[model samples]
Target: MSITSAERRSKDAIKARIKKIVQKRQSRRRCKLSDEELVLLALANSSDQWLMTAQIGEFAMSNSFFQKQAAQFLFGRTSLHASPQGIGSLPSRIESYLRTYGIPVHSKVDDENNKVYSMTAGAAYALLEGSYKKRSKATEKKLTTCPLLEIPIEIRMKIYHLVLKVSGFRLLVGTQSLSVYDDKITTWESRSQDALKMPPLNNFLALLSVNKQVYNEAMPEFYHENHFQFRDMGSMKNFLHNIGSERRKHMRNVSVSYYNLSAAAAGARLLAESDTLQKLTLTISATKDPAGHFTVNSSRRRFSSLTQIPGFSSMKRLRGVQQLVFNPRLEHDVVDAFLRPIITAPKPSKLSRKKKSNKRKRKHSELMSNHEAGQPAVKVSKIG
Candidate 1:
């Protein structure tokens, strides 16, 4: 029957907030609107509903500010002598006033040739008293949101580095999921670890779950930069099977201690698939002799222990590894045996080729110099 007091109060509150904003901004205008006219305009624009010129003009005409030429006021004319080019700028100026409070509006023409306006989803119009701080806090984000997809991939990768990269980070991979190993934690745990024990979780892995784009960009940063270590070659082989090829493609460095023949070989075979691998380091950390019939020194199990592992055929599969280093503790012959497969007949790099060319030129110069001096070139001997 009659408007409820709650409805009346809400109407008063919206009108008051809009009135204050419109009045304050319109105060600087050459032609200012009266309180009734401003309140009417503010209420008409407060909701997202469209307001045509005729409808808005009725409100203006009801007030003393506009008895005639309501159309001129609806158009851009701020004063009677305002330029014709100013048409449409008045509504935009009003919209600008609303924009200052984070409520923005957009306009379109209806079938009746009436220009109507509605709010854009782009704003959080928090005009109530307590809501000012909340809206103000979000203003910067609203202005600065450059979508993650829009960012250049190179810059995005650097950003990924900030979130995901860990310097000197060594992840201990297992048969399934694995824990991280700090430098303080040596790789000497018992072989039969409980599978139930949760592998320590890495926070950076959260980047993968953010979205597909971030996951794609972040994968290389986390996997490529960090060195992966294995307790034994056996675990590495199992991990190689389970580590998604997409992720494994980014891996750079890997180190595994020799504990089993079949595992070392099988893992090496799997590792050869990665063209991105830069280095492979094998450590001979086995304290006891393996179950092989090698006729080497019986007392020194460590040295002979390495040479006996028959994974050499599998070790050669690592064509992707730029450098293959063996733990210094192993005998040189043993290291060389494993090294031959991974780095045998290594492709010469530019620097090595340059060095070889320089060596030839130097030898030629020395030979010519010796000949000119009528002295036999002293035979150069390399003392091993």
Candidate 2:
């Protein structure tokens, strides 16, 4: 049959509405909620509360539509109101309830092990109403045992600060590597170049991924003093690639062994990128190779190239550098080169004069006694 344009447009509109209705029906089915169930659910969720639908079912055990009411209360009316799978909809329903009231629920699929329902005092009060007053009061009275977010902000901040202070990055443990490195040390080999090739900073950074809070808080400290093992050139390149210039600015101390000179050079390059490195501690080993076979020729090499790096040159202004030590092999030249700038930096005249004046005053006071005052004393003329 030939249809008129107006009739065709009306048919199209009807089809669109039907599609929407079907989509909505499918959605409700996914969440497993019904109309009458939704009304009860809304009343149950009137307060910002998180109770499992099973708890609501227990609450309404006498009701004929307990299963339906529990399902609706737990999930919410989705388009799937026809055959709502209440048991399957529990998680989504709980999520919906929490999100609807703007409450932040720390939910995890892994949280199945700890089914804790956290809520504010006011929310809890509203949820309990007068029905569970005594039990709610008893529960709330034990607020001292609650988590930080459960407490007031001021108390929470103090608690967070304490946690932060106590939860700083622990010492990096390289037991296996240290054992191997120690063996090389016993052989009197220069191992700095090899050590420089493998950096340990990445391993330390992995510690941050242990948990969410740790990632948030310990990241800065973890990267603050990035120490690269420098066992190979690969580790050196990895550190440079992973830790960028801006982050290196927070770097204060870099410990490089003689075996990992490449790593040291990479580190020096990385440090040189940062204008904020205050100190560089070189842990030069007496051994030369990985297996500890020979001694590296110290006179043939120097970290002078590091001084030329942009980051290292600016390191002089960082002000916290108080000491530098070189292994006996490079002690004469390397130690000299490292210390020369620090030693050459200007000393305060006030401090020198103060020390001299205090010494002279003490000496004179020691020599002078009440009985010695009776003897004539000869004063020397000032050369000035």
Candidate 3:
């Protein structure tokens, strides 16, 4: 069965030439195709076809050039073959290619009751760029139907401000620790304990929780336009702390009631530091002395402490405090004594000035009279 040496050499030479010819053909085919051309060719052949992973492998196997190019495009590899077993269970690269061309592949039952894949008419048209026109028309219809989005943003914000205005004077009340005598429930607890059960209702404030955009638009109006009332400085401090620093910037008008010197000082310090505070209305409720009488001296001392607080003393340092209104108005003398030193221009003491002026006039008249009567005028020196 052994062949001659010359015959064997001749057969080996023929095999080498065949191999060279095949390689040349493959190289030529690869050079002829671009990425876009390969994609277009694959899509055109599979248009409106529900191709499974196995079916796509068959198509790749038929064309050696396509298989090599497809593997490069899909998996970024050059040596892989386009066969059912070679592609494995999931052809992710192939699926991506199909999806990029707008081919919608869905699974369905074939006539033999086996699951098979199919493409929709939309996918077929998408290959030819017909679907883009349809999508553009649908988008235009949606934009035209929604008239609210079409209005100018500036005008929309104005409408939001008007609609979100607080209905009445906004009074922010805090829970005092007291016994509840209600028929339904009786307990000695802070109102904050029941805060979870009964939440305070502010219709205007409800707008803040709607969504991000609405909250942003409505919050500034809510804080700046409405007057906020707090029972005491403590309650106001707590509210401010809870709202955090960012939101506290919008608060313009604040009303608080003070019952003691410490409370007034604390409240003054807080308001002094606020960047956007325009008006502060302080209602000083008269506190009783040990004798149980509302003492003027005690009220005066408390008001004095407020002006002396380090934060409140430097009024010029505050950015935007234009007005300070006191309720149950204090006497003019009391205001001039304590508040005017901090808030207003210092006027010379009227009584002292008047006394000095009168004394000068009397001395001048005495000198004139003495000179006219031919008596030597004696000057009286001031003695301590």
In model 3, the worst 10-residue window by lDDT is 179-188
lDDT of 2 by residue, 1-384 (tens): 676898666555544543333234334324323432332333233223444444444444333334444444544544323443454555556667567755444443224563434333333334333324444567666643534345675664454344332132222223334312332232225334233222353443554554555455555454453332343333544555576765666555444444444344454445456444444554443323454333333424433343542223433433434445444544335334644476335444678869999999976875685338776455558997
lDDT of 1 by residue, 1-384 (tens): 676898767766665665554444343323254422342453445454566534554565464434334435554436644544444455555565656755445678999886676542112223332343454567666656638768898888888887775554466765455655553333344233333333245565776776666777787788788778887778888877887677777888787776655466677777766657887766653333365434222334333444455565555555545666666545445456646565644555779879999999999999999999999999889999
Rank by lDDT, highest first: 1, 3, 2
TM-score of each: 0.42, 0.33, 0.38
Candidate 2 Cα outliers beyond 4 Å, as residue runs: 1-222, 225-237, 260-264, 285-320, 325-333, 339-384
User: Can you write out model 3's per-residue Cα lDDT over 19-73, one digit (the tens) per residue?
Assistant: 3333433465473444443433333355445556556545554677666666765
- Colliding residue pairs in candidate 3: 50-118
**TM-score attained by model 1:** 0.42
Shift in Å, residue 124, candidate 3: 24
Please give the lDDT score at residue 156 for candidate 1.
Answer: 85
**Clashes in candidate 3: how many?**
1
Ranking the candidates on TM-score from highest down gives 1, 3, 2
The residue pairs that clash in candidate 1, if any, are: 316-341
